[model samples]
Target: MNLLHIDSSILGDHSVSRKVSAAAVVAIVAANPGVKVTYRDLDAAPAPHQSGALLAARLLDPGARSADQARDITEADAVLDEFLAADIVVIGAPMYNFGIPSTLKSWIDHLAIAGKTFSYSEAGVQGLAGGKRLILASSRGGFYGADSPMAAVQHQESYLRDFFRFIGIPDVEVVSAEGVNYGPDHKQKALDGAVAEAANLGRALQAA
Candidate 1:
């Protein structure tokens, strides 16, 4: 199986989402022996944010693109191709100000291509990228679940879930550590719980 693991946290070693995502990948590898995993750290190498020049480059003929535009287009295509080739995708997404990191959003912009990941049809919209599993390791500074007081403002996971669904991936699983910035004790407990959840999911995948 081909697995694509993407980590978007800027915190590097101090990132709980990274720890959870890595643990999940290990579990997947353990369960499916010899599974090929490709890892990308968005913080280390981030995709270019969409811009007018990038958009123009995409719409223009390849031969007409400027050197920089050509390079940007090529990079975007590579990101899309990598995502399309993956059977399983694991994402480490940390909440930033009640939303996902900009780097992660930039990565998504590269993948959500027309007539590639999705297409318009007589039936409305059709998603081309289906039959794949997506696992998200999310870290948040505050509680944002349905029961939380800030639930209404929780765009991190909710936005991700909707984005995936729009692209034809409806069955996304999230292992999250919330309230991490509440206190040192809360942070430790949240991390511990999220790590355990990731490990358990990995074991279950292996058993399956």
Candidate 2:
């Protein structure tokens, strides 16, 4: 099996999400010996955002695209290709101001290609990239559970879940390490819980 791991935390070594993501990867690799892993550190090498020039090229006929325009489109295309080829996708999504980091969002935009990843029909949006396993290793500074007052403000998890479903990756799971801002006491507890859950999730994947 091939696992694509993407980390989008600006905190670098200090990121809680990155730590949990690494643990999850370790567990998965341990369960499946010889599983190939591909890593994409979004903060280190951010996906290029679509430029006006590129948009113009996409609007035009494919045969009419300039050399530079074609090159730019090809870059994003390659990233999407990597996403499609992976059997499992593990992502580190740290909440930034109640939403996902921009680098992660840029990656999502590149993957959400019309006709390539999904399509429109009379029934509604039909996702083409189905059957892949998606795991979101997320972290937040505050608690935003269903009963919490800030629950409605939490966009990172809901947004990502919707995007994955939009592309037909229905088997999605999230391991959240929340309340880091609640101090060291809560931080340790959250990480321990998340890591344990990740280990179990890894075993489930291996059995499948």
Candidate 3:
């Protein structure tokens, strides 16, 4: 199976989400030998934020596109194609100010193309890209569980989950390492729990 692994954290080596995501990838690869793994680090190479110019470039003939427009549109198409080709996708999403990184959001905008990923009519919206597994390696400095008093202010995981669902991936799995900034003990405990869950998820993928 093809696996697409993405990391959006700008924290580099100190990123908790990156660590958790790497562990998940390692576990998945160990369980399923010969799985083709493709990786993208959004922080290292980010997609340009969506803009009117981007739309214009898409509308223009390929031969007429300027160098920069060609480059941007090409990357956008490549991102969408990668998601379509992947059987399983794992993405690292660290909460920043209660939301996701702008780079990650930019990547997602590429995948949410009408007709390519979804369709809507009088019958309502229908997702075209179905049957792919999505795993989110999430991290946050604060507690925002469903029962937490701060849940209402949380938009990271919830936004991602809803967005994926809108694109036709109905089952979104998450392995979260939260409260990392609380203290050393909280961070270690959260990492341990998330790693264990990631391993279990990897094993399940092997069975599938």
Q: Largest lDDT belongs to which candidate?
A: 3
Going through the candidates in order, what is the number of backbone clashes in each?
1, 0, 0
TM-score of 1: 0.94
Q: Estimate each model's TM-score.
A: 0.94, 0.91, 0.97
**Which digits, one per residue and each the tens of the lDDT, describe model 3 over residues 97-198?**
999999999999999999999999899999998999899999999999999999998999999999999989989999999899999999999988998898
Clashing pairs in 1: 31-206
In candidate 3, which residue pairs get closer than 3 Å at backbone N, Cα or C atoms, i.e. clash?
none
CA RMSD per model (angstroms): 1.6, 2.2, 1.1
The model with the greater lDDT, 1 or 2, is 1
Which candidate number maximizes TM-score? 3
lDDT tens string, model 2, 22-133? 8888899999988899999999988878668777788888899888788778877878988998989999999999899999998898999889899999999999999788
Error of 3 at 77 (Å): 0.3
Worst 10 residues of 3 by lDDT: 199-208
Which pairs of residues have clashing backbones in candidate 2?
none
**Total clashes for model 2:** 0
Alpha-carbon deviation at 197 in model 1, angstroms: 0.8
Please give me the total number of clashing residue pairs in predicted model 3: 0
Residue 91 of model 3, lDDT score: 96
lDDT of 1 by residue, 1-208 (tens): 7899999999999999999999898888988997889898999999888888788778898888889898888888889989999988999999998899999999999888889999998999888889888999999998899998899999999999999998999989999999899999999999999988987887676422
